[model samples]
Target: MPEVLFPLDSSKPFTDQEKIGHNRWHPDIPPVATIKPGTTFRADCREWFDGAINNDDSADDIRDAPLNKVHALAGPFAVEGAEPGDLLIVDIVDLGPIPQEEGSLAGQGWGYTGIFAQNNGGGFLTEQFPDAYKAVWDFQGSECTSRHIPHVKFTGIHHPGLMGTAPSAELLKKWNKREGDLIATDPHRVPALALPPEPDGAILGSLSGAEFDRVASEAARTAPPRENGGNQDIKNLTKGSRVFYPVFVPGGHLSVGDLHFSQGDGEITFCGAIEMGGYIDLHVDIIKGGMEKYGVSENAIFMPGRGGPVYSEWLAFSGTSVTLEGEQRYLDSQLAYQRAILHAIDYLTKFGYTPEQAYLLLGAAPIEGRFSGVVDIPNSCATVYLPTEIFDFDIRPGADGPTQIDPGMGAPRSANPNL
Candidate 1:
């Protein structure tokens, strides 16, 4: 059995505030616990929102939830045998559905999938889906059922979207300077935030009270993937994978967060996949000079495809765009690709698709996307592939909104009186 360092008491409801882990990735935040290498431990990770998000939440909830508080990580668990110049091999032993009895969420058995509907500044696809949306999923270990959406059902994978070790003070400083240069490239960017004086009450596990005794610079923001590997968002990092990332800090203070039940390739409509808090089993080891051997400047990870769904067949759409003079711009390529998704949305609407239906279809379907290439100079192209087998009926959209979907679509939901 794995060592229960940060154990979530399965006996009670998982709503307790005291048991949650720290959120920030700053070296100064200090380690919550320490362990020797080759040891496996269960990390009780908080949701990306900490614990504030809910089934009843609105788009305003997402837009208003704590912008800077982003991913509520579990721990900076200092591996005893790890040190600088070594590679921290984090073995993803297992992730979970966050047993309904002890998980953070109240509604779904395990998780929630959603889209950010901020009217102002939001995701890359915010303009298209300009409303708050969510679909709570009731997970049964491997398969998940949803009441909010009924047109689909698929097996869920326990994938931890974010995991990484900490960076040294020197490496942290270097990372900040380089990213700052990139931000400087865009003159309109505002001054960076060190540690926000306070985290909005909506998110749990945030740095507050004595936790702010030392605040690392804005460089410690948990979003970017740096040398120490914070948030890579690699979907295939499920079970049985060995992550080989450079260790910059002493003890390789490793942290893990942003636990996802399941997610598609391009989380096109952001906010997240089956967002839930649960236990994670990790077998961590340290490799000396592994970075030099692998020759990875950025963090390198290997994910096995065994534990999740893989693409077999897809109905794909391609987007092509070019300037009048034949010069291809990437922004146009992106726009065209997104437009093709909208086209798929329009096409599926004939079979009765709501905005949420279209969104969930994109999520549940095995959609594959690629920038393809920009080699033509004048024309660049991108492709969005949709799994044709997912739609059992003929190719047409209709009025099958949430309330009208076929009962055969998914497992029975105890919620949703409208159905």
Candidate 2:
């Protein structure tokens, strides 16, 4: 057991923890702890929603989930002697759901996947799934099963969904400016184009009064991936992964949170991954001046870990950049991926799964989504590969057709005021 630097009590609210963590990102938020390079330690993480979501069959919590208080991170633990222009080498040693615990809190032998309502924070397929839905999954060792989405069981590919070094004051200003400008384009859009710094639910480490007021007003939200690597949601960052983050401040203020029990390629649903609160063991080292030494000046460079479940056989579905309305968009990989996902959902319906159940399964399973073509003229092609083993029956198309499964009560749905 490495020294537990940032401990968390699963029973308490995130704000009630002894060492409080921040939800927004800013340079002056202060470090909870400091450590020399080449040190190994453990940190406990709260679920992104800080336990606001419940372990129940209703999707009401998902519909009204507080987007302001999110990504309850465990650190900004300063790496001793690291400075701007250097590279922070983070090796994810080990991590998992709360060990030996079983209770209402997520990651205590269970977790959930959700589809955000279009009125709230919509997801990649928000147009199709405009309402909120949820699927609760019970974990058993490395595998899990969901009653909301029956007839499916799969091994998890657990990993942290958000990790990054703090952005400098200059970089932070740029983020605010760029994002603010974008929001100005469609300020009233549901789910908005981007989230601005709101001081309502901010929990900055120790700052208060005027300082807290200033930072909270300027700090960036931890939703989208930035140059600082905030909320990239990469599913392959499992154990043994190596991430080289560009250190933009002294001491290399690194923070991490939003652990996922499992997630597909693109966490398509807003709360796509099997969200959990867990502990992560990390080994930190610095490359001194490796940022410029490797010609990687911005963003993060990572090597996917050798960990996670592997499946060789897949039933693949591909789609071009044509909208559900049959309009073609040129070179839109995102739209292509969206169409591919919809195609997968359509195919799964043949097996008796409601579209929401299939969508939740794709978001939580170890499915692989890849970009197959982009150079083509009027359309790009994307492919989603579903592991055949995860399903109890054959998923591949054949003469016998799809095998039906009892989808149970189906995923819980919420009343969406927006729709």
Residues 1-419 of candidate 1: C-alpha lDDT, one tens digit per residue? 68767755444432354455555455655676789888888887667765566665343455445656667677778888676778888888887755546444622366776665544223435656655566667676676667666555666656777888776777766776776677667645322322232333212233455445435233356765666677766667888877887777787778787887776656666654667777789988888877777776456666564677654667666767743345556556776666566666666655556656577556544467678865766556777777654444534334653233453332212222111
**Highest-scoring model, TM-score:** 2
Please write out the lDDT profile of model 2 over residues 246-273, one tens digit for every residue.
9999988899999999999999998899
Q: Scored by CA lDDT, what does every candidate get?
A: 0.62, 0.92
Clashing pairs in 2: none
Number of the top lDDT candidate: 2
List candidate 1 stretches off by more than 4 Å: 9-20, 57-60, 100-108, 119-121, 181-213, 216-219, 321-337, 364-366, 392-419
The parts of candidate 2 lying over 4 Å away from their true place are 416-419
RMSD (Å) per prediction? 5.9, 1.0
Backbone-clash count (model 2): 0
The residue-level lDDT of candidate 1 at 312 comes to 68
